[model samples]
Target chain A: MRTSITRNRILTVLALAGFVVFLVYAQTNWDAYRLRILNLCAVYTIFAVTFNLIYGYTGQFSLGHAGFAAIGAYAAALLTMSPEQKAANFFLAPIIPLLRDVEWPFLPALLVGGTLAALASLLIGWPALRLRGDYLAIATLGFSEIIRVLFVNWQRITNGSLGLKGIPDHTNVYWSWGAALVTIFVVKRLVDSSYGRALRAVRDDEVAAQALGVRLFTHKMMAFMLSSFFVGVAGGLMANLISTIDPKVFMFFLTYQIVGITVMGGMSSLTGSLVAAVLYTVFLEVLRPIESPFDLGPLHIPGIPGMRMVLFSTLLLLVILFYRQGLFGQREFSWDGLLNTLARLHRRVTGLWGRTPPPSTVEKGEQ
Target chain B: MSRKKVLLVWLTLSLLLSLVAAGPVAGQEDEIVIGVYEPMTGPQAAGGELTMQGVYLAHEVRPEVLGRPIRLVLVDNRSDKAESATAVQRLIEQEGAVAIIGSYGSSNSMAGGEVAERAGVPVMGCSPTNPLVTEGKDYYFRACFIDPFQGRVMAKYAVEELGVEKVAIIQDVAQDYSVGLAAFFREAFIELTGDAKGIVAFTAYQTGDQDFTAQLASVMAKNPDAIYAPGYFGDGALLARQAREMGYQGYILGADAWEAPELIEIGGSAAEGILITSHYHPEAELSPASQPFVELFMEKYGERPSAFAALGYDAYMLVVDAIERAGTDDPKAIRDAMAETKDYEAVTGTITLDKNGDAVKDAVILKVEDGEFKYVGTVKP
Candidate 1:
């Protein structure tokens, strides 16, 4: 047992070392475009894990992520944009008096945006958490649409449909990956606590959990608000990375994308979300040629413009159909699994090289 | 386990290596790369395709500048704001383009503008008419007139030529172009008539709204002499049909967005008498230098060029002319040359950029006659 614990510690140290090495190498060697794509992957990882916390563990079907994101994006954008930019971008109507001169640095603005989104989610969750199944889904969907419409018409604050431009390019590898790591750590800690067990119990059997004196609404609200806060920060990072945003950027389709990621990864597994986010983000950029004109030898084929989404959906469908429980199911990366597999491989190699070892002898040796 | 980890690391390394290899490689330094982004699919595709046609033809005419071949890198923005931003970044960074031209929709152009401004790469819009697109951004410019000028021209045409006193407006609130143009038109029209009640009614609908009878019902109740509907062709057609069917006989005035073949097809005969202000019309006899371009466009595409096409052509020619004047492939130098442009002959008209980097030119007034936009006259702005 002591050896196993030591092995686990060694593996964790090695994993962390590998991560640091990757960060140093990427920061030194990558070009602007590659670095931007890497940062986007990190942002998506945070978003995906935050979304999983609500839909996976809490068993809440929330579809207002885009709405919350839109709030965050606008809050951060308005807070960070210079007063001169606000005047210029809002040339038609001119920005509202209060927000015209309000400019905060990137970090404070991002924190404020997340806090505002969490408060907004708390308000939305008051009425929304009472419902279940598709009813809750439709209500949340309507909320997102309302948010988009309000942003579009509220010209003084949102600059109307023109959206805000010239948001400072502040997102980088450190900020994005740092946020992603913080999210994973917090969510893992939460899921291990007693509160997390109650949330899961509600997810599995709401009525039975209610009978056991679990506060369903409070547990759901906690998960919802916490998830929304992280999602909001992720949105702020995305706006800074892209350097612009509009109401159209947070369409219902954006929520659908989040849902797709949460499902494709195992909803119950943060590691699955991390891996899926990286694969999805990198592959989206890598598969650009399929939607673009490219010379492949002598076969000159005109690009199908929207082929990326088509191929992406088909790949997603294959994953869901083949693996019912998703990539990692409800399981996570464990040191025991690694150690057991390593022991079996060692025994097999020894058996093949010299004298064959009995299974009982191999078990004794491992002990 | 360690061997498997080694194999995994090898696989990841090879993948990263392949991606890096697929990135833009260093080619001959003499070829000047120019990037163009447009929506090839989605709601605004027709406008994007028309603009691209003009740009391609312009490229065919002048493919060399400063004794170096110009290579055009065209990217599809998919009519999405985020995609538009990424497209411009890819153009400037990964593609190593010196100057960029693009984007039909005003919102999409704004997205591209943010990226170009941050990267210090110059981007010229072909048909984005929003004033904010180029405002306060040194790196962003446009070859088309802004919404204020277009709106004033249409309002002048309505009051003087069409002889309209009272008017109603239906704008697409979701579209920045439509809302901004409508506001400008309302201000100009009210000033011309010298009465606050000159514009009797104002209503709005979101983009993708198909049923406009409700909005039209309220608009018709005001008993206005004319209806100013500034929106895209899809909504424009349905509004015209519905307004005419509801027995409102006043003229329907529109903006440059109505210059499309699909407008006539969808609106049919109901669109016959609609008046619109445009960048160019086939029947207008302006510069003789543009005759060859018009003929070539008609011969190649089997149709007359729309205003977007003409603007696209003008934008491309202007960029190439700036590159020639700069005598260097440097982006900042090209930007200076582009800003110094004066009275350059373009297919649309003689183009001279004002202090705000907007073209100071004439807006063509066209009336729908016999399923086509026939030239009436031109209004200088």
Candidate 2:
């Protein structure tokens, strides 16, 4: 066990080192299109990681990501926008006096956006923490819709449905990936703590956890607040990265995508969420040609739009059917487990072990 | 089954799938690639598909430019803002397109315009009438009249022809184009009457909202001379039907977005007397380019082209015309020549690009009658 822990730490250090090198290469060499996809991967990584914290660790099924993200995106976009740009965008309806001349740097704007989202989550989670399972999801979904509608109609503040153009392009690979890493690290540390055990206990059996004095509401609210803050920050990054936003951008569809990511990645594994988000972002980009006009032999298959989404949804369905426990299940990535399995396979092939079966590294205790 | 086996199988399948995917990245060398980024699928799919048909028809009419076959590399924006920007990026960076033409929606055009502007590639827009699409941008150019002109044309018709003094405005707040046109129309109508209270009621609804009884009830209670509801054809038809059912007798005026045939079919008898400003009328051959475009479009598609199709055809022709005048396939040269466009005749009308890359063109008013669109007189800009 001691050796395994050391090996895991070493592997993590090496992996991070390799990632830093890759980031440098990407920033220097990749074009705007490639870098955009890369940035999207990081943004989604933040969303998925935060979602995994709420839905996976705390077992709270909330569909209010869209609302939180909209708040963050609008907040950041408004704050970071130059006063001149704001005046130009709100030509139809003048901006409110409070926000007309306000301009903050990207970092402060993102932080404010996150803080606002956290406050909103506190208000929402207080009442919503009472409901469990599907009811919570429905309530959160309704709240998200309300947020989108408000953004649509509140022309004075959000520019209504006309959308804000020329949002400062401050999100690059560094900002997105840095935020994603922070979210993962924070969630990982929280989940590994004693507080995390209480949250899991509440998830596993809420009545018994309450009997054991777990303070279910507090734990759930903690997870909810933390998750929303990162999600909001991720939303701000997306607004900057896209350089355009409107209420339509935060429709319930955005929440659905994050849910799909969290579910497709293991319901428990942060590493799975990280990997799945990147895969989702990249595969969406890489699969573009499949929808483009292509000639197969003598038959010309004119490009069918929306086919990529159809194929993607079908692929997602297949994965769920085949791997009912999700790709990672309750397991987390570990270097020792992988290396030991590879070594065992090698020995089996060489017949050096003389038919002695290697021990399985799959964690026996399922949360 | 052991979990390890499932993981291994999934990993192996993904690797194989990626290997298979690598086969489809072919390069074009001889073809002059003009990238098209439009919403091929989503809420705006109908408009995008119709406009692309015109682009296809025009490509068939004139397949080559600068002695090279024009290959239109189209990327679907999926009616998403982020996707629209990336679609433009992919077209300019990966596809090596000389010029871009796209984006039926104003929001889409604005989003894509930023990327194209940054990349220093010129984009020719089709039917995105919002001023923001081409405003303060050198790269984004459109072949369609802006919203203010469309609004002004309807306002002029209401005052000079119909003599309606009181007009109520109900706009789709969800759409930038609808809101913009409605605002412009209100401004023009108020200005023409020189009365701040010329507009009786100003109401709004969202896109994709199926119900409008409340809006109509409020609009009808005002007893205005006419109601100007600038929105997409779906909403326009719905509003017209609801307004007539509510016993509102005043004329219904809408913007060019109501030019689709669905308006008549959906609105039925209520659609009669609804005056809509259009970019082109198939029967009204205003320019020499109009008749041939109409004939070729009907021959190819077996139907008269919609206003969107006309704008699409014009956008394509204008791009190719700029390429010819520039005497090179270079994007910079094409942009320079396109910026210098004056009195360029296309299917839509005689277009001269303004300083902001907006086309100056005349508006055509079409009235719905006997379940058919009849051409009224043209309103010169």
Candidate 3:
């Protein structure tokens, strides 16, 4: 009981610290463009986390996340906009009477969009859940392409690849990070529950889990639907942030990027994914100024415009090659460990000055 | 322990102090920096590279603007709207660019325009023909006519000149330029023909798609007088080749983006007789301003300049002219000067900036013949 209480205290401290840091960063950089990118990062964090729930926790390999995202983006875009704008741009207004005339607010549109995406996942998951591993990956990849093709062709509904633009920019850091926080909290709680254990059991050995009274299909479908709902919400957020939604925006390449984030961050670790997302965006931003040619004295190297992609791909390849288990693997960063290190450093310095303290007492105090 | 702690605190304080000491310099002198943000990679790389070549060639000819050495900082936006905004911001905040010239695609230009407008930097577009790029934005400007005018001119060419009644449009739906042009063309064609249903069928394809068999099959079912496809040259060439292979003997109409050397290389014999609307033609024999540019371009590049190259050249000259007229590197002054541009004799033609910041110029119609794009005639817009 003492250990459990100490763990809860450490968790609470870490949560508060993280919130304070985030608030400081957001307030310091009040630029709309920077805030927009932060909001996008938050949306992506939600996507990567939910994607991790399926591909990492449940061991389901699917690449249709972006396709579902596109569905949600267009749905939310269509749902929230004034009917006159929809009629002018898309030509085919939503046929459902309730959806047709109603210009739903941003939050309701996002919720409804996520619900629609969840329904789509149910429709696709019913057939796709029967498949395993590589087959599932290929099926989902194909489904993403089909959705993109439909968005390109169904101009009447999706404006046929011209993309839905002029979307309201209601996606702020508060909304995005708030959703991200809730997603992390809920996903963490769900993963620690009995349902998570059953899902893990199925992932480890499906036949055995079935024999052990685990409802395999039900658990898998629930995980799939929940993951799709969060991903759909991320999509709605993304659409609002970019103020546009093109079919190309949800191409297979986007799925590849998300998969890359998951692999580089460690599949089963939420903290790892979060850290990786920040690192990836920061690295790309820092590398931009270096793309131009440097003017050192007596040497003028011309700029190579295509080198950015080369560097990114090469770095990604190196990470995959050396660290196949990912940078953090499955280990989550703990505040207790960080505090212990700080205490140890203090003790070392004090001991060097000829005054040694008891480590056990300090450890107990930290606990 | 106390000494070490004091030392650590002092070290951290010094580092912070040094960082603060390295803050803002007084003023930037010695170079006139201009930002060139375009899609140097991705599906639109070819167009972007050609446009860059045009801008680079302009600097090569005259490296000074207002008696100061011109420095062109090229930023690759990777053809993404979000990245375009970041690129523009970097140029404005980091590079201290006096003006920005970019963004071949309409969406990219529009995205960059927002950043430039917010930062109070003048953004001169190279080939983004969207009117909305400069509708109300005072800082945004372009060197080409808008899609509505270009689309209307092409529609007139298709209906009156080509004597086509029913036209089918196979557009790249992912491209804002293509979609906007297609919509305007449809509207103009219907109005010209006085029939609301003049178009037989309108199909769509995404960018980077190589196969057009499915779309072509559907389009062929409805036999129209002509097929209008306003897409990039790569996709347009493939579509032309496939359509011809499928025995489509209708007239094919394209936009300025289809006037590349690769179009002929890819489409081969199938590209013959394909007509496109453009702003520049090396063979037009315009004026004294164009003769030297065309001659120099052919001498340097071993081929005549495409519409994009000419437009890039015009964009740089226009910006330089604005700086010279304004007599300062201030973006607001340059923008004011740019707004007052009239009868600017460019290689493309005589350009006049209208109230909406679009160039009111003549449109050149070119037709491919014998593996080369031949100048047909100029239609005054």
Candidate 4:
């Protein structure tokens, strides 16, 4: 066990180094479009990880991710937009006097956005966390709608439905992926700490956890607030990368998409969330060409819009149907797990399937 | 021992498989690509489809310019703001499009505006009426009159013709176009009537709202002489039906977004007497270019073209004309020629783009009658 721990530590370092190399490669070589898509992947990774920290690990099925993101996006956009740009956008109603002229750089703006989102989460979690299961889901969903409506009605702050445009393009591979990495690290640390175990205990059994003196609401609030903070930062990154935002951008559909990805990734595994984010973002783009008109031999396939989404949803359904517990379940990726799986696959290819060690050997080894 | 960990393996496998299957396709060769980013799917799909019909019809009418066949690279913006910018970028970076034509929704155009501006490729909006779509962007141009102009026209028509004194405004607060048009119309109505309280009631609803009783009840309480609800066709039709069903006999006015035939079909009898400020009605063909387009549209699709389709057609033709006049398919050259466009006889009207890159043209008023939009008259800008 001690040797395996050291092995995992070494592999973790190697894996992180590998990620840095990949980021450098992508930054230097990828074009503007590819880089944008990659940056989107990073932003989405942050969303999935933060969501996983709450919904996956803490077992609170909160649907207010979109609402939190909206708060973050608006806060960052209002703070970062130049006075001239704000004036240009607020033709119908001038922005609130406080946010009109203020222009901070991207990093501080993102932090402020995240902090606001976190604060909003605290306010929401205080009341909504009293409910459990489906009620909680509905409450969060309503909260998301309320935020969207508020963004639309509060024209002075959010520019109403017109939204803000011309957000400076400050988000590159480094900013997005670096933020994503920070999110993953923070979430992993939180989920592995004593607070994380108490949260998980609440997930497993509220009665037992409460009897054992676990303060349910406080722990739940901790996870919810932290998750929302990262989600808010992700929203800021998205606004910066996309260079435009409106109230409609943070509709319930955004939350649904995140939920779908979290469900596809394991409901409990941080690595699963990371994998799901990359798959969701990259696969959407990769599958897009099928929608565009293209020629095949002597036949021409006219671009069929909406087909890609259909295919994507179909794939998602299949994944859910075949693997009910999600992709990673409660498992974490380690060097030994991967190496053992590879060796088993090699053995099955060359030798007998029965000769391969049973899958529980790793489970027992981990215990 | 639940195979939950297998989720990563399966996901990896599927992603790899898809990456291989969706191998990079070859790029087009020796053709001037005109990128089109419109919401081909999603909530605004109906408007996008109508605009695409016009773009397709225009392309069919003139397939080539400057001795090179025009290849359109169409990308679906999915009615999303972020996707709009990405679509624009993909068109410029990957497809090498010389120009772009798009986007029915003003917000979609607004999102795509900056990307095209940065990339130095021009985009021609088909029917996005919000002035901000082309307000400060040098690369953005449009084929239709802007919201401020149309709003003023509607306000004038209401006062001079309908003689509406007390008007209520119900706008889709979620849509930039609806919000801007409603605001402009309110300003003009107040200005024309010379009454501070010309707008008796102002209520709002989100887009895709199926019910409007809450909004309608409040507006009816004010008992306004007219209700100017300038939203998309789907929402407008539903609102019209609800208002009529609720026994509100006042005039119901809409803007260009209410031009779709679905408005009549959806609202049915209630849609009758619904008035709007529009660009082109099929029967009110303004120029010689109008008749053929209407005829061609009917022949091709066996249906009458909506006002948006006409604007879309004009946008495509304008781009092609600019390319021909510029004597090159270069994006910079095409942009220069586009700004200088004047008196271009288009299906909608004679379009002369102003210094702001907005079309200086005439607006038309249409009324839904007998399951069709009948042309009332034109409002010259």
Candidate 5:
């Protein structure tokens, strides 16, 4: 009971600390462009986290996350844009009466997009659940490719890859981070619950889980639908942040990149996934400036332009080979642990000087 | 328990280490930075690399602009729309680039344009032929003529010069460039034919699609007088070879994106008699500037220059010329100077920016025969 209480206190302190730091950082350095990238990272965090809920936790390989994202993006885009803007952008806007009159507000449109994506996942999941491993990957890949092809050919709805533009820019860091935080909280709670254990059991041994009264297909389908809902919400945020949606936006490479992040972050670890999302985004951003060839004094080094990706892929491969459990594994950061670490370092330095540490450090060191 | 503490300490140390990794970018007042954002890797890498090479060479030969050393900061978009947007933002906010040049693909260019316009930076595109790039945005401009005019020019060439009555289109549906050009071509072709049903058949393939057999079979069945495939030269060349192998005897025509060295190299003997609309022709020495630009490009790269390289050169020269005319890095003043640009001797042609920020230049028609793009003539669009 005491250990549990201490754990809860540590978690609360850490959460509060993180929230304070995020608020300070976001306010101090928040420009439209930086906010835009922050919003993107938040959206992808939600995506990666929800994707981990299924692929990482439940051990289902899905390559159709982009398809669900596309569905949500197009639905949200079509719903939120003013009728006049839609008419101006699309020639066939007036042909469909339901679409012509429909201009749902941003939040409701996002929910509606999420609902549609969930429905799509349910529909696709019914038959897809029968397959396993490589077959399942292939089916999901084909599903995404088909969705892309349909979005391209269905000019009346998607504008035929000319893309839906002039979407209202309503996505902000508050909306994105708020949604991501709530999603992470809810998913963490769910994963720690009995339901999550059952899901994992199904993942580990399907037949045994079924013999133990777990409904395999239903549980998997539920997880898939839930994952799709969060992914859809992320997509809605993406559409608003970018203020545009194209078939090209939902390319297979995007799904692969997220998958790479998932592997690097350690499957089934929510904290790992979140850290990976931020790390990946920031790494790409920072490396972009230094990726080119530069000259320092007498050295005229040729710019190897695409060397960044080579480095990233190599790092990813190394991570997979060496640190297979990823950076955090299943563990999360706690403030008590951090404070204790600081206290211990202070103690070590004080010991070297043959003196007592400060009261604050001693207090933390006792914990 | 101690293992967990050690892990926590490691995590905290790493987090702190990330902070130490951050560095401040020291800028020199004497140097002018120009940001070049393009798809340096991915499907559009070839085109972007060509454009970058052109810009790099331009900077090498003429390192100083307005008596300040010009530095080119190139950022890769990875051919993704979101990355392109972020790249433009970084270029404007972090690099403090006075002017930006980019983004060969239409979608990528549009993504970059949003950020550039919002940041109040002038983005001179190398070869993004979409009219929408500068339709309403004052900050966005390109060296190449818009696709609508290019489409109309090709339509007129096919109908009036080649006397092709029936034309078919096989475009890359995923590419806004190909789709927009195809639409314009269809509109112009139908208007020129005076009949809505003038096109024999229209088909499409997705970008990065290797097999064109199914698409070609459908187009070949129509047996049109000419086949127009407005896609990147890689896929366009492959389609040409595939169509010929499948017994297509009609004239193959393509848009400006089909002007690459790989088209001839990949299509080989099958590339013969393939006509394409382009902006530059090394053989067509329209102005005195063309000779020196071509000579310098060949001297540096040791290969014949593609239209993309020429446009990249022109885009840089136009921005530099505007900067020289404005006598300041003020975006609005530079924009005004860009609008006032006329008879600017570029490697591509003598350029004049219209009120809409499009280049008013002639389009050259070239045909591949014996693995070389022989310049036919120029069409004033």
Candidate 6:
């Protein structure tokens, strides 16, 4: 047991050291496009992990991620944009006087955005958490639609649909990865606590959990608010990284992406979320070439538009069909699992050299 | 063991294929590269393809400048702002482009413009007519007039030519193009009629909304002489069909977004007699330099080029002209030369860049006659 603990400690230190090396390498070597993609991967990692916390670990399916993200994005954008830029972009109607001259740095804006999202979840979770399964999904989706419509008509605040531009490009690898790490650590700690068992109890059977004195509403609301806060921070990072945003960017499709990532990453596994985030982001960039024409010597092959979506959906369908419990099931990657796999392979290799079949089996083979 | 071998083979093959498909190595001294960013795939693909036809045709005709082959590196923006910014970064940093042209939608162009502005590279927009696109940017320019001018032109046409005193407005609230144009049109319409109450009704609907019965009912009750619906083709056509079904027979006026063939295909018979203000019309009188381009475009595509295509062609030509005038491949010099453009002959019209990097030109008024966009007249700004 002591050796196992020492091994785990060594692994953690090594993993952190590797991550630091990668960050330094990326900072020095990557161009702007590659760096942007890397930053997006970290931001998506935060989003996917938080989404898994609510929908997978807590089993409370909510489709209001995009609305919460919009709240956070607009909050961060409005705070970060200079007053002059606000005056320029808001030509249709003037911005409210309270927000006109407001400009905060990146960290404070992100914190405020996350806090606001948590507050919003507090309002939404009160009524919506009472419903179960698909009804809850529909209610959350309806709220998201309402949020989008409100943003569209509220021209004085959101600049209508024209959107705000010239947001400062303040996001970098450190900010994105730093936020992602904090989210992962917090989520992991929460899931390992006593309340996490209560959440699982509520997820498995709400009536039984209530009989055992577990307050389902409080546990679900905790997961929901925590998820909202982290996802909100992710939205702020996305807004600042791209440097422009509109209501269109926070459509229902954005929630679909988060859900897709959480499911594809094995839902309940934090490590799965990390792996899926990097894999999915890199896969998207790699598939862009398929949407572009390429020349193969004498032959010129034209690209088919929308082929990326087709291929992506097909891969996702294959994953869902083959792995009903997701790639990792309810288990996470551990050094013990890796060591067992290696030991099994070693035994097989040694047996190939030394083992002989029994006489009864040999006779059966001959027959 | 065999399965592992197969996987290894597949991985090696994929790696080899990727190496072959990678972009060209940097510092190709013989070719002077110019980047083109467009929404080659997605909801805006049709507009992007039409606009690209103009740029491709211009390249076919004039492939060389300053004794070097001009190579255009094209990247798809996916009709998304974030992707557009990344595409622009790739163009400036990796492709070593001296100048860039692009982007059909105003938002995408504005996104790309921010990157180009930061990188000290010039971006010439083809059909992005938003005034904010070049408002504070030093390196962004466009070949088309902005929404404010276009909106005023449509308002003047409806008030003076159609003799409509009262109008109703339907805006697509989710789209920047729709909202910006509607705001300007409302302002101009009120100024022309000398009364704020001239706009009898103003209603709004979101982008993907197909059921306009409620807004149409509200608008029809106003009893206005004309209705202005300035939006994309899909929503605008549906709105027109719904309005006609409701038995409101007032004249329908539209803006440049109505110039696509989808308007006729979707609106059907209701699209006829709808007057639109656009940047280019196939039947309009063309300058001598524009005649060959029009003919070539028709022969190549077997269809009349839309205003987006014409602006795209003019954008490319304008960039080439600036490069020639600058007498070098330096981006800053080309930008300065582009800013000094005056009376430059383009396929759309004679363009002169104002102090704000917008073109001061005339807009064509079109009518949907015989299931096609027919030229009615021109409105000068």
Q: What fraction of the true interface contacts does model 1 reproduce?
A: 0.40
- Report the lDDT tens digits of candidate 5 across residue range A1-367: 5886688677787876898688668857787657767777788788889888888788788888999999888889899988876776674223266787688888899898889999988888999977877887889888888888898888888888778766777787777887798889888887778889988998888889999999989888988998898888888988888776789899888798888787788788787788889878876775664465555446654566776566566567656655768766655555555666787778878789765544442122112
TM-score of chain B of each: 0.92, 0.93, 0.88, 0.90, 0.90, 0.96
Q: What lDDT does candidate 2 reach at residue B224?
A: 94
Arrange candidates, best DockQ first.
2, 4, 6, 1, 5, 3
lDDT by residue for model 1 over B1-381, one digit each (tens)? 343354356446545533443443344678999999999877778789989899988899889899888888787887887778778878888789999998898888988888888778888899999888888788888889899999999898889888899999999998888988899999999889888798898889998899999999998898899999999887999999999999989989899888877889999989999898888876776566578888989887998887889889988988999988988989999999999899888888888988788888888988889997888998988
**Can you give the lDDT of residue B223 in candidate 6?**
90
Error of 2 at A223 (Å): 1.4
The regions of model 6 sitting more than 4 angstroms off are: A303-314, A321-324, A338-367, B1-15, B23-28
Query: Which residue segments of model 4 deviate by more than 4 Å?
Result: A1-4, A297-300, A345-367, B1-28, B208-223, B245-247
- The TM-score that candidate 6 achieves is 0.93
- The deviation in Å at residue B363 for candidate 2 is 1.4
Looking only at chain A, give the TM-score of model 5 against the true structure: 0.88
Here the TM-score of candidate 4's chain B is 0.90
User: Which CAPRI category fits model 1?
Assistant: acceptable
Docking band of candidate 5: acceptable
Residues A25-72, candidate 6: write the lDDT tens digits.
997898887898899899889988888899888999999999888888
Q: Which prediction has the highest TM-score against the true structure?
A: 2
TM-score of 5: 0.91
Q: Per-residue lDDT tens digits of candidate 4, residues B1-381?
A: 344455466557646544543444444366788889999888788889888998988888888887778887788988888788888889989878899998888888888998899889998998888777887889899998898898899999999999899999998888888888888898988888899798899888887789999999998999999999988889999999999999999999998878777899899999999999988887776778898888899999998888888888999999999999999988999999999999999999999999989999888899888997889999888
Which 10-residue span in candidate 3 chain A carries the lowest summed lDDT?
A358-367
Q: Model 2 residue B287 lDDT?
A: 81
State in Å the error of residue B140, model 3.
Answer: 3.0
Let me know the DockQ for model 5.
Answer: 0.33
Instruction: Report candidate 6's fraction of native contacts.
Output: 0.43
Clash count per candidate: 0, 0, 2, 1, 1, 0
The CA lDDT at A158 in model 4 is 91
